[model samples]
Target: MIRLLIADDSALMRKLLEGIFTAEGDFDIRTARNGNEALELVRAFDPQVVTLDVQMPGMDGLTCLSRIMIEAPRPVVMISSLTAEGAEATLEAIELGAVDFIAKPGGAVSLEIDRLRPLLVEKVRAASGARIRRTLRLTERVRHQIRGAGLASRPRPSRVSPSPVAKIGKVGMKPGSATLPGLVLIGTSTGGPAALDIVLPQLPADFPWPILVAQHLPASFTGPFAKRLNRECDLDVVEVNRPMPLKPGTIYIGKGDADVMVAPRAAGVIAMPVPAKGSYLWHPSVERMVASALDHLEASHLVGVMMTGMGNDGAEAMKRLRLTGGRTIAEAESSAIVWGMPGELVKNGGAEAVRPLEDIAETIIEMVNSCAAN
Candidate 1:
């Protein structure tokens, strides 16, 4: 049985969660009334996965998560509300090493919880299997940020090997031409936000191609998530709410709950959020998004990046991209929290280069520059 802990100040909330997992018959569960109690149980009970509430009585969820990351590193899933404030706090918790989160049931009553039961259970189970080693890497990032420009951070991802210029973007594009720029298709989930933090921040404001991101999130979280990335990165980041003109130096985040796609327009190529495809298991699906891009744009002009996430959402289509003469990069196993998405890409022989998380930005830069020179 999977060892699990549920931590929340509300007795009702705690009980409701316990019941949900107990019904599954695969969990050896424990409960905590508050953060202090939760901390004690973490050391004493030693659960494999933890569920923390955002608004607990004693120590708030964020603070509690901070302590847990330092005291006992384990997979954690935050129980968050649906509001903007809840999204912000949950994002912080993820940065602090939480593997995933679920929006709490709408009402104080248990009846509403049935709707979230399946997803909540899946997230908790997934968290149980996630690698806690990502937490150590994140802690290193946090410490570097705390130094306040004192010493440079740990080595940035090493310089990518020199690749054929033709293998970069479109094979024969000359510099300074009027031809519209190519697109970068990026798809990730689960630990995507933190993984994006490491890659996107490394790119400069003048990045040569537009990047489209499909990050798995609920509808309420994507807007704020895009805004947060905008503040931290040099390139402008915006949610793909409408059919927006594709421009270099801008990163388009696919709206949550829908699939973001690329299609030809009267003016030019545009990035737009389309209704989620019924066939894809994950919304904002990486597979569906990459397929959409392939249908409208030249395969050689596209660069597909598969990063930290669960399942094999992007592996098949990215493999197709590589076979069709496009480039692809998979995040290395050492840096992935789950090693599912990118691992599949590497296993399938799609990834032209497998890079550690820190080196992805430099790799992209090199690929884009090499393409430009050709």
Candidate 2:
């Protein structure tokens, strides 16, 4: 059974969340009215997952999250409002070792309760089994430094070589075999729903190439996420199935309880779902997806884009993508809800282009066109 601790100052909010979790069955629920009370409950209950609100009467959620990472090292999901300040604080919580967060809907307890039901349940389940390690002091120090310095104006590397243009399938003119997207991989997290909504719908129907997405999401949510994307986008998007063939304009989303990788098959590409064990310390690992894509696809035709999210999950992967002669783009900070993931990529020189959410679709289309032309 999964055990959870709910920490919030609002009496009604806590009651509603407790009621929801209790109704779900198999969950042992505990409640805390403030950060101090939450700490006490943590010591007493030793819960598997914790849902902490950012604003509390006494110690704020960030402080409690920091202490929890130090003392217990359990999975924590922050509940924050959608205001700019709330978003900034939530990002701080993530940096302080909170695994993920859910944005409170409409700044109201009732509306948030309704909109967040699915996310809350999914996060609680995912957090229950996560092995959270004690956060190192150095990590926190580095995060503080990065935040203080402001990452927006960091210098970017000059493009050494232009991306090769490649065309695939019936979408466009057949390029001389030289130019083609060798591998197509995407990474997204928090704010992915809205960002993908904007980007995917703009992609033309029958666009050629196999696209793999590694969105940081719990297993229960991937199926719905893929379906939602499929409905809005012209291309086919589906949760990955083992041994499935990789085809043009089809997207395979990594789903729950497994890490999706691509392996070369005599017939074509095969979806390899590995046990979660160490395959992904976190769900929908961007590193695993990017590494697998690079190994399976030719270097010259690779393209990697890191979308909005908190933390640096995709940073290393983006670096690997760059080393292999692939084109890489990151969602610019201004357009991102959290900016932690994409900002890290930009700071580390992993992204070849930093673009707003509105421009991502056009940028990708241009990249594909460039590949074809090459």
- Per-candidate TM-score against the hidden true structure: 0.88, 0.57
Query: Compared with the true structure, what per-residue lDDT tens digits does model 2 show for residues 96-159?
Result: 6676677665656687687768767866675565434222333554554665788633221112
Q: Which 10 consecutive residues of model 2 have the lowest summed lDDT? A: 154-163
Name the lDDT value of residue 265 in candidate 1. 69
Model 1 TM-score relative to the real fold: 0.88
Candidate 1 per-residue lDDT over residues 151-209, each given as its tens digit? 65433322334332232333322233224467888989888887887788777766768
For candidate 1, the lDDT comes to 0.82
| Candidate 2 deviant stretches above 4 angstroms | 1-166, 169-181, 277-279
